[model samples]
Target: MTRSPATPLPPPKARRRLRESAALTQPQLATRVGVTPATVRAWESGRTTPRGRKREAYAKLLKTLAEEEAARLAKQEQEREREREQEALPEPKPEPKSKSEPVALTPAQAFDALYAFSAPALVRQTFLLTGRREQARESVERAFQTAWERWPEVARDRDPVGWVRATAYEYALSPWQRFRPRHRHPEPPPADPGDRTLLNTLLRLPPRHRRTLVLYDGVGLDLPETAAETEASTPATANRLLHAREAVAGRLPALADPRVLHRRLAELASNERLRAAEPPAVRGGGERRARFRTRAAIAFTVALVGTTALTARTAPTHYEPPVSPGQAVRGVPHKVAPGSLSDEELELRQKLRDQMQDGPERLSPRLE
Candidate 1:
């Protein structure tokens, strides 16, 4: 047997939805429709039907609102169904662990690792800063020696490379190096004209600007890290970097790019053999000597103080004026006799008299 088609729902229920969707209250809807709100409510409740123009407008509004609501519901249902399908499927397996895990290093091993990794870069950076290969090598070596000497503290530091960089930078800038005869020798010009020009240009910058540029771009440190290494505030570091970039751009337009600078520095560092160089010897003597000097100073100071106190107490007291009012009034220079002589003159006269009395017996012959 054939089934009958389902009847469509009445527009009265849709009238309320249409008004709601239109964001209009019954009073507002009534104002729009030019009818009382009670009449609008009656029409929505299916107790009455709008007639003529009102009927036509109400039916059109209801049709449009009903279609929009149907589309929205369909979209919501589709999303829910998709979520259900996704929930029904099996979850993916977690990735497998790698076969080899990183091994933890001891302090010495860690220091060795850092020395191997950072020496070449540090040497290259120092070379750029100082424009002297020997000075650069010495600075880097001295910095590493210091690191090795205090490996435990260095290893515990957040950025050991930064620490070494700061140390090497300071070492490269040492004023005493100017006085050393070896450092007095003029550096041979760089082989590459480009390198020479770049080095000269970099050297021309104020030391702080040069240091900021190198630490930020050359060493690839972040602004805060760069600031910390350079001992400047972040804002000051940023300003220095800006001025440094401007200066470099004015001189070498091509090398101003950070990537190009990094590449050029890498090329400069490539041929330098870092791995073959031995780990810097950790000398405990400096610390021992420092401690010894401190103890010696303390002992010397105590001995000096004790000696001063003993002398103050045991030594003869000189004649001092009394503090009494009468003595203060009486304290004055006494008049001396016109023929009076100093004690030294009197002593000399007495010695002459003795010599005169002794005569020829006391006289000793002087050799010609």
Candidate 2:
């Protein structure tokens, strides 16, 4: 008895349940999974499977949905329990409260809270910096996770949201630094040479200069705040601010015309949309700071190793002055042209050739 072909393996237990519980019109599930309804039906009937990782992922997805529903239900139950407990307790006497309305938050408070609230600026900045919405989301989410984990500590910080924004930016830059490929050049952007040159020049500026300019002018941070974020003295920050402005001013063709130059320079800054966009506040204080320090250490180590290796490998092969063209040896020199060979050299060459061709067959031993 073969047991009726083992019931065709029961349609991949997960898929059958997923199909039944989804309440989706068969075509809807099919469209969702990017397969035909008939194919989904076959999977449910145990006639076939999606195969390999696809099958596993399909199963995993069902399990994940199930878990999420369970967790949600549990949270709801917990909330119900809290409500019941509150209802069971005795009410306390109300104290007379102050009649003054709540104070309006300042710009700083608005900035701090902005981390929690999604903004066009945050979304735009993340996309520009990471070049992927998922990655940008992940960076922001990671900051959020950190912020949540250290809520107590982050709440105590002067600028919690700014902390989150900064963290996200650092996270966006992390992959660029980690997977830096050697000898692999970046693709050239299809743009005017002058524009490209100008962009490249901006990239060449020091990080402090770049950040200062981008923050103060581009994203609309004031100089004192920019200086604080950049950790530069106010006067020093002012000098860098002036220099960055001057540098860009000098490079612009229209600088001689004040209004035109201002517009052109603004346009130039606008091209780097990410740098100019506002960012989400940073969430995690302790963990983010630790991760930053660790990443920084790793970067420093890599730089040191790379520099040392480059110096060591190139040092031994340093070139000396050439006595003759194509005549330089590892540790010796020889005449490049036959005419340049001295009588002594010619005789030595002859003896060397004789030793190679004759192989010591003729016994002309010299007494030393």
Candidate 3:
């Protein structure tokens, strides 16, 4: 006789995967997600499917993982939305007043507003760059306030924060320039120190190099953003930053050890004394926004140099021999002329003269 049909088994494998993915103990997960241990075990063993809360929690966890994956896409969408809003917003026209009337803002009012507006960002940038939590905050605030008095020119630009950032960065670098010429700190030869050691090494790097390194590696900027900030191209910026890192590395053996680099960073953060004892660089206001233009100018200069080098390679170098007292006849060289020169030389000279005479205006407006 034929046997009765067997019941389909529950999915134990799916339940076990849920527990593993959540990284929870079986009893703990069962309690948290509101399921009995036996039920959890049965689900994992494929003896039964979880109903109600258990199934819901499992679905919820999977949804959470999926959400993490979508986070980048969501951020990109938000950025696009912000751009659209900025584009759609009408430009604020100057107060409809007579051109003869000056728009006056009191220095005190301007200073206070600017200081308040930029202090936070400036402080954060400084702390990120130097890893000096307490001192940098004050310095950044001071730097911004000092620069705010000159905001009239800065406000005219599209991006004033960039200008301010560049100015503050320069100020940070100024300390290296002022190191006593007669008395220098002895270089700590080789063998990297702990986290505090590396942080100190980073601080010792010159301002431009430090800023370039921090902006590229610390801030996670691509070449263009870095070039925009530091006024160097991707290649130039990359080289300068890498060189700065190398300089730091050369001083200590820790550069060879990735663990030391990270450890030193952690140690510096933990060392409250080091963070607090450092002197402030700026006084109150933020760097003016026009500073980015200065960076761009620097990058532009580098580009010009590169262009010149390229031009030199392909350019024809026709050096003119100096005229001697008795060497000239019709402005052509005697060596290449008639009598002493052959018939072919004369033809070549004549052709050269004809070409010069008939050629279109070399210095015409079109060329200019």
Better of 1 and 2 by TM-score: 1
Stretches off by above 4 angstroms in model 1 are 1-107, 271-277, 280-368
Select the stronger candidate by TM-score from 2 and 3: 2
Model 3: how far is 119 from its true place, Å?
3.1
**Ranked candidates (lDDT, high to low):** 1, 2, 3
Top-TM-score candidate index: 1
Considering summed lDDT, which 10 consecutive residues are worst modelled in model 1?
A: 274-283
Tens-place lDDT per residue, model 1, 1-368, is 99554333356755666667656787887776677776676676665567777766666656676788788889999999998999878989978768697777876677777878888778888877888778888888778777776777777654699888889899888778889898758888577788778788888988899888888777787786676567666678899999988888898898778888777766654544433255534234334555788999999999999999999999878877878654333677666577988999999989888775646665678999
Clashing pairs in 2: 11-46, 147-283, 161-281, 161-282, 163-282, 164-281, 164-282, 164-283, 165-281, 165-282
Error of 2 at 116 (Å): 6.8
Model 2 ranges with Cα > 4 A deviation: 1-145, 156-158, 168-179, 182-198, 253-368
The per-residue C-alpha lDDT of model 1 at residue 173 equals: 85
